[model samples]
Target: MLRRSFLKVGLAGLAAPGLILRAQATEQPRPGSPFIVTYFDLPGIKGSRDVTDAGDGTLWVCGQRNGTLGRFDPRTSQIKVISLGEGAAPHGVVRGPDGAAWVTEGGQNAIARIDDKSHAVRLFPLPAGRERANLNTPVFDKKGILWFSGQNGIIGRLDPNSGKMEVFDAPRGAGPYGMTRTPSGEIWFASLAGNYIARVDAETAAFTVVDPPTEGQGARRVWSDSKNRIWVSEWNSGQVSSYDTESGSWKGWKLPGDKPRTYSVYVDDADKVWLTDFAANAILRFDPLTEGFHSFPSDRAGANVRQMDGRSGEAWGGESGTNRLVRIQTVKPA
Candidate 1:
């Protein structure tokens, strides 16, 4: 595999005489291993918090600082910015079945959908008398239903066609965070405050919450693997866990750093798991087949990478604190 390393130097330091940023050596790819890293510096995208692939070669990114939306095309390397209105406080994003991009506006207690072609925006408010929406992560099921987690201990669903809405109560103070749908159409979610992984049956509307194997550890994000197992990131415990849907069993791996604050968890097409260490400013990759681990740090400190999505041997995420979009391209084994 051909491996390369690149560094982003600050303008102030680079303009001072002959000073140059040191080139950190890239990690060597082992035999039968495939992965590489490519970093893109997104200007004016401070607080890039979450990203979703539009499935048409476009990437939609959300901002934490000002609730802005950005569109990027890998082919053209062009980025366009769209304001999500003042105080939108956008978080997780997903492409709805209606072909619009749906986002959780944590600041506004509502869900908004953006037309993919026109960029027209429409807002859907939470049910009357419901607590502040604190709407966070969102995902769409096969039937065109959009589901999202609210910080105020509830899961919400919206039918884009009819604008009908439903809310399911979670345990008090659960703080439901990221969510994903399984092949069976069940919605799996992580609870940052409740410390569990939950599943909601699409047909029956029943809910199940599974305690993490590590007691007292809060799950910040969740993703379903190809094998039908759900993976979760233990934010405070610095660990990753897997729950077997068939056997109702659980297993976990402790991250390298203590109290690492693992913010996001994703499994690529090859079944390898990837995690973001917010405090550590690094991306960690774990190979389930080999049980081996690899770590890559960001070019800049205080990056605070929050969420990610993977596609075509590449992974993209937003740096919430720095307001930048980070990209990593994996170099396949030779």
Candidate 2:
């Protein structure tokens, strides 16, 4: 395992002078747009990927390419980077109830816990024979147990208190990519290769697969809205769809422009749907009430933001290609 170290960086003292300002210079949203966009260049984090609210006005970001995790404070324009371990390519991160950052540590094939206060790193490797499970995402159930997915046909759970872990085969052979917890306490995951979304029984670990309306839509990620509806980003179909878990109905909307490749989907605190489109190089916000889409294209080409999470007024994502963290502050429409 690799040794862990913390590097505190302030934008003012960065060796690459004016790098953050240069990134922000081109980030202005279109004129009259109700959103203000800002970009922060991550000093040492390469592949700044999946991000989640760290609960204390900061965010936890996965440094996939560089094998690290970063705690970013927006107000101070500072970040604290913590190394995971040798070959530790973490994919997804979420702030757990314990105020720690729980990571799907793909490189180590283990679950990692980063203490919020101490910046301590702890690993819980999977049971034998589950090597290279390709861990992707993790979500916590109502009972505080952690559930996670693997691209290599595995669904798993961990009891943080007991230090016990369990892994189960997914319904389809592979492609469990993103997982989310609904307000109703149900867990749902999207299968990128299997092209379906499924619900996991928190108690039994049984999976009930749900097919999207479009075949081969390639459901890459899912987020639950306030109504408990599952919003999916279809990579193959280039559409954003929502499933009404209660009504058993579905709705799909194709993204604007040609060859749109929807990579991630997030439902904001106000129930607004946020999506990242590869083709347009933009972050889109979909208003359910008006059925309209607003685009916030990145000024730079290939801004490929992978995942997003946020608080009440802001949506945050990592610009994996650019190695920057982006924040879009939403101003409510009168």
Candidate 3:
């Protein structure tokens, strides 16, 4: 397993004005090869955070501002908004086995399910008094049980069939954020406030937490590769890291540029990691095998692309600040 590592290079050690000038000259976005930008204006989407492909060409987008979920049809370019009641504040969206799209409503502290065909919405309340149930990412397991990490440091399982809920506590204020399951059926999640990656065995309900190598750089999101390694993004540190399940070792790569705040990370079918630089207003592609990095800026500065989904050779992302959906198609090398 080749783990990519990117370290901050140049200028930090320099004390002279001439060295500072030379570093600035080399740090500009590449010149003249135009990066195409096609924006789809999503009305009433003031705080779009996550976008998930429904595996059928349509996309499910969640809004953090209004607790609304919008469905976008790529082929027809039509948009449909489903209200999850007042103050739902949907943050993450994914397709479930029931053929409906499931969303985590952060504001109202609940999970919601929306029918793809009928556009009907059903809300599932969290266990009472669990305020941390807000800001969850729901993942369906192999046995069809829906697992979610609550923002306030709790993990819960919701039985979609019976609507029964079971909850477990994480470290106090861990702020469990993005999550993914391994091929072996263990769930791994980022502990944003706790600054670690926590794992839970599906069968035994046992939990373990791995502290990140860099302090003050809490884990924000996670994704799994085909080889079963878990990759996590350190939002505050501008670095990405990988954890090997087989070897039980961790490795990391720092991002390019100063203060690059990565919000979401995804591994495409080709196994390359794609990151959205929220602070720098750019999208970065990292080849894990080569440790090669390529970056392209969003059309507008501070576009704040929060989440992305890769499908069919294209990457689709939600731009929160711009109130639009962005598509990035791969350009084959000549």
Candidate closest to the true structure, highest TM-score = 2
Which lDDT tens digits does candidate 3 get at residues 1-334?
1111221111111211110000001122334543344567777566777898876778888867866777777667666766667656788888998888988777767677777776677767665566646666888888998888887778877788777777777765657888897777778889888888888777655678888779978788898887788888898888988999888898889888888787788887778888887777888888999998788687776778877776757777887887778876665224
Worst 10-residue lDDT window, candidate 3:
16-25
Off by over 4 Å in 3: 1-37, 331-334
* Candidate 2 residue lDDT tens string, 65-152: 9888888888777788888877889999998889999999999888888888877788888777778999999999999999999999
> What digit string (tens of lDDT, one per residue) describes model 1 on residues 205-282?
667878988987889899988888899998888888899988999988887775677889988887889899876788
Clashes of each: 10, 1, 2
* Higher-lDDT candidate of 1 and 3: 1
Clashing pairs in 3: 67-89, 67-90
| TM accuracy, model 1 | 0.87
Measured on C-alpha atoms, candidate 2 has an lDDT of 0.87
Candidates in order: C-alpha RMSD to true structure: 11.0, 6.6, 13.6
| Model 2 alpha-carbon miss at residue 13, Å | 26
Ranking by TM-score: 2, 1, 3
Cα error, residue 44 of model 3, in Å, equals 3.2
Better of 1 and 2 by TM-score: 2
